[model samples]
Target chain A: MNTSKTQKHRADLLVSCVHDRAPDLIPALEAEVKRRGLEGEVKVVEAGCRGFCSMGPVLLIQPDGTFYVNVQPADVPEMVEETLVKGRVVERMTYQEPSSHACALYEDISFYSKQHRIVLRNCGMLNPASVEEYIAVGGYEAVGKALFDMTPEGVIEEVKKAGLRGRGGAGFAAARKWETGRKAEGDIKYVLANGDEGDPNCFMDRALMEADPHSILEGMIIGAYAMDAHQGYIYIPYEHTLSVKTMRNAIESARAYGLIGEDILGSGFDFEVEVRVGAHSFVGGESTALMHAIEGTVSEPRPKHIHTTEVGLWGKPTCLNNVKTWNLVPEIIGKGAEWFASIGTEKSTGTQVFSLAGKINNVGLAEVPMGTTIRELIFDVGGGIPNGREFKAIQIGGPSGGAVPASLLDMPMDYETLEEAGSMMGTGGVVVLDDRSCVIDVARYFLDFLKDQSCGKCSSCREGIRYMLEMLTNITEGKGKMSDLEVLERMGKSVKISSMCGLGKSVPNPVLSTLRHFRDEYVAHIEDHKCPAGVCKALIEHYINDQCNGCGLCLRKCPQDAITGEKKELHTIDAEKCIQCGVCFDVCRFDAVGVR
Target chain B: MPKLKSLDELKKLREQLQGDIKARTDSSTTITVGMGTCGIAAGARETMHAILAELESRGMDTHVTTVGCIGMCSKEPLVDIQQGDEPRVTYGNVNTEMVPRMIEEHLVQGNMVDEWVVGRVEG
Candidate 1:
């Protein structure tokens, strides 16, 4: 029996979600741990996002798996005195299910139990700032295997066998791009990790980047070896300060450990990676546009008639993968292609991490198998819609991605299925809409966001989005002509074909897809001159109902000061003073604010 | 944090680092203390200090943690010791003087102080 053990610390307190809204908790935990002279027995580690954003700032005691939710500095001493000193569980601090009213262990939580974790495996498990913590959990082992045990051709062949596709919206075959870059004629080739996550509702890449930057680094290292590229760049948006900082720290740690730089792990393969801050615009997600940005130009998409795999960045052959794509590399190499292929669907293998938001309970990052149904993700994983509201539609992908109504809740999600439903699996940013959501207004909202971020390089995209926004606005404000609908469809087709890049091409997806599935919402807004969901401020009117019961709550909370009420009398809204901000509708505890 | 030279060395380093993050890889027997307001008021804090001091003096590393109130306010300063796969035993009204004997008999000697035991929680 080889019993060489060095279990020095009795309890390792791994704090999840420090980068989120939670305040500084470790310092207080550390100070209390020391006061008891149990420093040798207790250790506090600031881990990365656990993907459980709803119960953020949670503290997990490893070995025991005692997870404490909503941990504050004030709770540290009692926790230390109880759990750290005496090894008793604090029931009040543990995670309690919203509906079940039952406490659960970290792994027992349905949000985590129902899903499979790959990219997030190392996220909340280690100190991302430390290379040793990464290694302790089998971090760089794949890089070592690729560097010494596998040949360049072998690496690419394994990836090809795995059937991994680019996760950055395109679903382009990842290994084929590596093959192109490998065979491309150039002495100076490059591999780029696209960290410019521009999707508004998505933070999957940021979570991985800030939490497990080493995973991306290791993946890029394997890619560089496969492509025989000497240098690479991780292009992050400047706004994700934590991602930039953690990635830089990971690279530095990798360098100091000799896992990066010349002759890594005693192998002759040489590679280095540097972070290139890029424009955070949606257009920058395009490979060519990102290449241009890396070359110190404006992030504008150019025609991809000539593939960037042949010639990119400074006229050199370049291989670019999303930060998520890079993140999956080391796993495929270490765990074998067959293991990865065994998961998800046959074609779209492996898991995808989705950032859940918008009118949904338990909004956070979830990594589910490729073919998970929309129902499972919403009800089982996301804890269904908030306030017991009926889920109206579950929007997959992002702004450029289309909306899938509740009628197709059981549709299994994959690249082919989502695209067939008129939505591309664009970066897995899921936004669930309740019955209160108007699909027309939803389309208008996305088009509005895209309109702001559109590079304006292509007239079809620029003018198409402008025209769509105008028509959408007209329909919402009860000014739409029936002919406007036909023109919208015709113009949408023209825009789809004439657009130069994805940003332009997918600009019409929102309008076209919503029209395909939910035409009645648009008809109601146009034919009946009624905002069915009471969303369009121009069409809807608000008034206090008889159920108000003299509640002064809305009066005090109303931003516009349009509500008037005595101490014990029903409130009345000054219609002229009401700006239709909907604050009254949201704040009314008695559901007294009526909208039409 | 020495620069690793080869894959074999990296493997060796992993085994060593695995020990560093032991709580991450494996679960072990644990010791629990109730630090509820009632427990603390009944001298649970001093009891914890004694437990830690006794273990520290003996150069022992144990998995000691805390819990909230267990609804036994009269039986405050409750301390429970659990070995692997064994039913957890709770001692009631524990004082600082009882810590050394508890650690010696329950933890080191693999025997419970049955006379002072108030409850048994079977896994």
Candidate 2:
């Protein structure tokens, strides 16, 4: 009601309207703007996630590029009165350096300053619902060039020259797959974008899809032109409700704008895209299983005697690429192969978007060029391990990927380098672990995940994973003999060699990599029946230390009520009644609880 | 919302849209007011309006905009001004009356208000 004369102008306030905490903050911002009678001069526009989840409820002031974090509804009035009406920055809301107490701009923050944004270039910068915003940032230009100026062979050639590999895990050459589909003997060819991101702690693909859906769509359209495919499908997991909605909207808008559907851009290249949502199945991310799911069949992978590029979806030549892989097509087509090749390593060209999560200070998506060392990714970009804990290991890739020890922190993170270090670059999920994490328990956790996700098609995968899980369970339970380690090694190798699909083949990665690196932890568990990190419940016990001031906080928080003491006296845990839940260890604020 | 017919049309559209973006995002001189909660509480909105009114009165082409807090909440109502390739000068606790002097000295005469300047961002 208090509309000012200047309120009709384009966005004056750009609130980060992400799914996390923006919903509650938006109304407060609007109400304050209205109450202050500055509505006419200040227009609020809701944008996507700004990648700084730890400091969410973030706001970015335009024109001057001032960034605010940890904003609350209560601070709205003064923000409007001081900043909006008086043209003054409310210093209390600005991001300050933790140690120096100096203010930092968004570009100057180390969390955003050190990273290169290729796949995530558009994230936090544009409104995903608006197609014009996508186009203004050069979204569909690559598809136009591919359709009008370049031939199909030229497009494929450009991709090959860029040295772009599949980002889905295997690092297969994307252009080679496109060439296969182009040359495959089939009248009806298909191109698929695999959005079924199954890796735990990885949300890079989901972020790209939800934030910049058009980029993926544009990439797929170009791929369709290169592979001579008439139809394309974007297979996203159903749990990704925002991604599905944004992608479906993006496809519709593109169709309505003549970027897709029949006679795209009047270039006579008729290609259409459909959004398919499937239930989350870990094994369903496999190419063959994905294609089978698209065909309305059971989501299970078959033997790959023939490559999917030659024999795929509905028994036709289907060119399937990961969401991130397809997203790169537009950039390569727009900037040329040489420009893309100049960014990363010689073999692995371009930047990799990593979901940096677990035990790190900054937990979000980071895009860095290939050949970036694990030390830089973890310490520099990820803000190092949280709470001053010593870095122990990083579980690179996902459940199927291997763990890299602290000694290998300097190793460059590329497909071949990670593989040579006994780990595969599985979808770029970098889960850092600290000294408190038990390596044996980490291996057992991943093995348990794989055992559940395996398709159970082959005996090597089904039986081998079962046996491995049993041994790991025994080791964690402090019931394992020394000879079981040999059995684990033999069965792990057999699974890797005899499994029918990638899921089965890579299931032993966590076990084998942990064995190869942290065998001492396993020996400690087997021989001395001791969990070094105090993680295994059966091998460890909790006790109150001398530091306890008898705060009674731990006693109240204990679910089993095993701890008892006076109000101001050190508490003792009844070892028989204690379930070793570690609640006391976690709740004790005085560093009094000890586990050994 | 007609479909772009050809490559030339697409390029032309991009140029037009880019012109609009550049008008707002790029300029020879940029004046930014921090409008985050801290900035607003400290009277940054008033400072921004003053700058906007001054620019409007002078009919200056200099781009004026608002950014979120830059983590100096202790010094509320921060203003940053940049001319050409020169370093951006950050002014702390800026008030409404400082707008005209900033525009006249920094924008017109190319002389920075050094006493008010708190920090400098390297170009």
Candidate 3:
């Protein structure tokens, strides 16, 4: 370290460094620091995901807790010179609130302020690759406490009193499953950590695994000890290579530290963990299918007549929990059950991590209490919809989950409440939709997704999903009858009841929920042969309004050359040749293009 | 590092590690400079160097670090001085000339340069 000739420097400058996809800003920052000869005076450290991905590459200065967004390489010199050398803040780089016009600090920004980060407490705060950093923040204290202070029975009872449910999708009580696994008559028992997150547009598990790998390991160890499981498996999808690598490293580090492997912490408890990578299949995330895959068999779901807690992973008692669910165990043990139960609603205790994305200003991961309203998640924390668009609906859960209309925005976001509102809190993926989004089109999109992912174990799921897709496609293409609605409702209900696993059962949620909320849009498409949102291609027609200044930008973009007219005059679309592609509507600067 | 043998050992290690991190990051008086794109364009680099040189000569243990932009683009080159748990005082349109006075008043004498303060971070 080059000593600063004047005095020994102590302050460290931390930057939000990006290695994948986004441009790496660390090189420029380092170059500027060196050019100024302030290497030893100011230490530059790279931190992990700052949660505000949209505004990245972000930079946060610690000790004072100042945050900057949308940083470019060219700006590094001035930042280094002024902030590092002179201790003066760059006013332009400071965050200015859109509404209040006040310069917002890191803690004051609504995106960071509105969050209740229980699961994501360590994320974006520490260097994820360093286990020492994790330990410094009180990481494995729970595992130590569980080993020394709490008995196996005591741990289970505390979790039961905490009311922590499975965060994966089903919302089943975690302690209940552990008790079943403990009581089952088996010579060998196993604890399986479900990192196989296959939900569309959901990445809370991926973020948790990447940011804090040891949390999951600590939780698994506690769960393994509580259930008397000697062996464990962490099953992650192949697509999540980062999570898999991080988990593997964490396990090895824990072993080296004697926190895992035989006689952990001198407690005489023997538990070994192995990482299992699986193909990215939507149905593979199902409990039984995951167990089969782990046992080196074809990944397929069997009938759930017998619970996995009794018979799982090659005919042995197994306790399977989601990654987020396992991450919560350590916290519940560290902080007592009553403390955990005090948060969230009466039934749903602890916070839920939601991947808030689509049609929102701030798109990233958010962890809020169970009772946090949809309005708070979308408006307050999300910074509302971008470009001042009105929020139409929010799709909670993944593609298999339902969409709730804006009218029910105040509904509390808990497992039971969301289920009652025609949506399950499956994997905590809240996708917001705006007014321009078509309800029928949204239902068709999810149906198409489910139809492709459906495993052909049960005819009800395989054929039922296909039939529903065909019906939704017909409605969008202006080829639907009034009686098709009744058929769709009947088919959806049957599929929900007769499907073998969670994947097939909840497949019709998108269709059912959209149909229940936006039936008028369906009625308009079928009865009047018109798409209300002007989304369905076959049912809608494009026309040039009087507002057209005849820019000819649309004429150049039209593939079929359906538009006609000279420059600087109102253009016309020939009805016979027009494809109704809506390219003109998107390209028009003066709002000249109209769809009906 | 040796393996933490017991719960008491683990707890003691955590306390020592936290203390080291807290000493560097959570000192009584911390000065943060906003060094986002807008701040650099406004010549915040000169202001920063001036403050650092002043602190070095004075031999004060005051903590100073550079932070990303806080989105106040119109007011480029901002400085925030926070002492202990009190509200953070933000000074805007900061330059090299303002650095010595601000450090002397805020860091040495424990008095804020009132006119230069643009905003205060309230709890």
DockQ of each model against the real complex? Answer: 0.30, 0.21, 0.19
Candidate 2: where is the Cα deviation over 4 Å?
Answer: A1-12, A87-104, B19-28, B32-62, B66-81, B87-123
Q: What is the lDDT of residue A517 in candidate 2?
A: 94
Worst 10 contiguous positions by lDDT, candidate 1 chain A: A1-10
What tens digits encode model 2's per-residue C-alpha lDDT throughout A382-480?
A: 878776788999999898899999999999999999998888888999888898898878888888888889889899999898889899999999999
**Candidate 3, backbone clash total:** 34
- Per-residue error (Å), model 3, residue A100: 4.9
In the range A1-596, model 1's lDDT, one tens digit per residue, is: 11134345656889988755655687788899899887766788998888888787888887677888888888888988777765577788988775686563777777888889998888888898999888887889999999888999999999999999999998899999999999999899999999988888899998899889999999999999999899999999899899999999999989998899988888877889999886688888888889989999988878888888898988899999998899999999999999999999999999988899998888899999999999999889888888878888867789889899889999999999999999879999998889888888988999999999889988899989999999999999899988888899999999999999988888898898888888888888888898878888888889998998886988998888899989778889998998888988888889999997
- Candidate 2 lDDT tens digits, B4-119: 77777766665445422332244577777777778889998778778877775665656666676689998879998887889999988899988889789887898888898889
Report the poorest 10 consecutive residues by lDDT, candidate 2 chain A: A1-10
Model 2 docking category: incorrect
Candidate 1's DockQ is 0.30
Misplaced by over 4 Å in model 1 are A1-6, A20-23, A102-104, A564-570, B27-123
lDDT of 3 by residue, A411-511 (tens): 99999998988899998988888977788898889888888788888999999988999999999999999999989998899999988888888999998
